[model samples]
Target chain A: MKSASPLPVVFAAFFRAGLRAKRTRVFILLALVPLLLTLLVRVVDPKESGDFFTKVMLSLYFQLLVPVLALFFGSSIVNDELDGKTLVYLTTVPVRRRAVLLGKYLAALLLAALLVAGGFLLCFLVAAFGRLGEAAAWGELGVFLGAALLALFCYSALFTALGAFMKKSILAGIFFVFGWESVVQYFPGVTQKFTVIHWIKSLLPIPPGEGGFLIFQLQPSPPLPSVLVPLAAGALFLWLAVLIFERKEYILSDNA
Target chain B: MSTVLRAEKLSKWYGNILGISDINLEVAGGITGLLGPNGAGKSTFLKIAAGQLKPKIGRLTVFGEPVWGNPGLFRRVGFCPEHDSAYNEMSGGAFILLLARLHGFAGAEATERTDKALAAVGLLESRGRAIKAYSFGMRQRLRLASAILHEPEMLLLDEPLRGVDPLWRIRIMQLIKDYGRQGRTVIVSSHILSEIEAMTSEIVLIHQGKIFAKGDIHSIRGLIDSHPHQVSIRCPQPRRLAGQLVAGEFVSGIEFAADGGGLTVRTDQRDRFFSALMPLAAQAGNEITEITSPDDNLQAVFDYLIGK
Candidate 1:
């Protein structure tokens, strides 16, 4: 008998399970941090709310919160199965391993996207409160949302690949987020462009020298590379993840 | 009978420790028990057959196809892993239904198959409960339900009755027997000899990562029965019991405990020895507090069989 495509099957089941997971609950609360901070800023300094949103809030969302969320969600796409000893059910089915990995990847991507976008929208509405009528205000929100998604996509895919390749991948992911990405993104010249945040920060609407406090020595690349680089890098990372998952053997239990 | 599974020089190891050695085996359609003690490579062999781990050297095949990296083979295969694992957040029904859908059963058919599998495993009534709420036995049954949900041709169950209650144990054993009676293949692993003996006469005794013996249970039992067994009897009057028991031809030797309250008897005929000890214990003032066979486990039996 021809089997149902396991991609949708796995995606649907994991998505439903993800909704009730403790991590999702924690992330829901984490996503609300920026919204709560935006509310605080709106009440304190009504005049410079938009300025704070573009400079400080954008840096907070793109540089810190987005990457951290992506790291947790993406690495867990494969790591959770291993730790839980539940990979047997999926692998023993009549579906390809690629389908299993991709299905989980898609589910995690969607869940993280919702968390980031939901919080960003609420924060934007409060920060750009009176200017909601202006098209430019909504357009700026659109740009920030797009950049946040690209960052999630790229970071999540990279972490997914990292997870598929190693048993204990969270440590490497922590190092990448805090040690490599944090330090390398500020390096001068082409070295700074090597980091994922560089492309993401370039897509923001904040003008140079204006956001020096949040993003010091920021050199925004051209719009085309900023968009294409993350997209291409995300695709490459996802492909690598699938490749590793399909070929590599995972020893679930200690040998007897 | 045609062979349903085959392995040629199959071997696996973790670092320096061996899993299963360079062994060869073939199994046809019927119940074949993989009997061994803990860390005797039973799980390793099953994991390799189930495609959970790749063979470090050699190969394994099911239905005439390599099991590793071959997902299509699972269409005709079902594996109930030994690990106590499931999607704890999902209800039992949802867990089976997910596997049903993945197996190509859609909508009504998937639900129907899920219920049928659960019912067969006696979990149908508790289908709506989350797996985390299920007892260990119930979770074991849920894993069984997941394996048989698709009704595949071959079933590989590793320690299926490990944590089950006595009633469910009998039922699960009967279920495996019934499945084998359908002319399908079933490979059940267990460390308990009686458990394997109850399911099928055919068994493969694995010890120290090698196939020690593979044949009818009666033949294996005969070999084990011939090995002199040490039966330890605890009593207040060890001298009286020893005096009465030392004359039997089956009794090879006797050793007094250092504590002076017990004696260990070596006998080739365990059945005869036990029958004789019953009368001794029944006599007035010859009270037997406890009786135990120190070397009755599979490991000791294996050690004897290997000439240790």
Candidate 2:
């Protein structure tokens, strides 16, 4: 038998398709919201732009947008195929199921990363326009981008596994983001560590007393563990997604 | 003949509803028409064979290996599903080319196969158009093109002719016949008996989650032909036509229309009855306006066979 097409071929085709997808367009608009907010704060009060940018990055970008964007992009990796009844085409190919899932997952991850990076870069440039020459300011931007990447990797992988496990994964993801992450991250001591946001929040360069109601009493974990936990968890979740996808028999139609 | 597909005591059920039950059969290469009515076990059996669904009980194997979770088997198998589904965003050529690439064809070879498959299905000119813009019949043909683009040893088509125009239907049927003639296994499923009958003489009759019968079409045709058939004839002189039909050896019984506009004739031999009715209606005195066999369809024949 002929060898199946390489993983790059599947990744390239799906990546191009993912860019044109309607969901990606919606995400592009969603990612732009932070940039718009940064611009508005910069114009109204230039002195407070730096501080507002930090708050926006923490509450909106990291806590809300990153996880939600990952949820949309990552869950759709499997859900979209099932909904469109296009899974048959992918499953029937000579390639292994793991290759198909990983190829699509990589496409979704890249697409989500582009959205977050584009929006974050613009928001950072607008907020730190006056401080561009300073090394410390550039370092802070790098840290934020690094934290955002880690948060996205962790969240997207988690949601991708959820999508493979259940059909109505968006509902479950919404609850995890709002109900579990929102409430659990604020809990004192070790309990907050259970939520993914705790590790993400620890990586952010937020001063102890500055985040108001969102992170006033937040006990951030050490930077190393924070970064390591998300990386390890993301890898675990991604492996789970592949495991479920390969073994599970998805019924394309009404059992026919 | 070497067995291409085998199902040993295979059964599948979705909760309370049974799909196929205890289906033990072996299919050899050449066209085997899966003849059944709607909601019969035909689609279920095909889906299991295609590796789309796992059997709830027993096993189904294609080319001696289990089909479920066997992506490698697809290298030798092509399946056109029953649902009218496609990536509406992609052009017909693009869709076929993607499947070609997935099947391991690269560069010019993928494009060539795509071109050939599209041309075979008469979609070559409109290959660049998005599938959504095409009519239902066009999409059906596109699905057929996708399945054949790989040129696998076995083709499993589930209601492939559905929504196809009459002109293309004959062409598609001929294409399937050519595949059979080339010594490949082509299993085409359809609810219509004449559709399957026109394609191949070998058939498997499935109904209510079971294989009711399997053999040459002639045997099933014999059973249907022997069943009492009702022929309704509208005529100006119903009494005269009934009087003539009463003497025929094929006429088992006759009933006059309550409206006095037509007569319903029961015949044991439908072909002979039709032959006798033609001459009577052609006579100068007899004026037959219309003639229809009410139970001439396969559904009625199935109902009689299954004692439904």
| Candidate 1 interface CA RMSD, Å | 1.5
In terms of DockQ, which candidate is strongest? 1
Model 1 misplaced stretches (Cα beyond 4 Å): A1-3, B226-296
**Model 2 error, position B75 (Å):** 0.7
DockQ of each: 0.58, 0.37
Candidate 2 colliding pairs, count: 0
lDDT of 1 by residue, A149-245 (tens): 9999999999999999998898999999999988988888899898999998888887788888567566789999999999999999999999999
Clashing pairs in 2: none
Best by lDDT: 1
The CAPRI classification for model 2 reads as: acceptable
Evaluated on chain B only, what are the TM-scores of all the candidate structures, in order?
0.79, 0.78
Poorest 10 consecutive residues by lDDT, candidate 2 chain A = A1-10
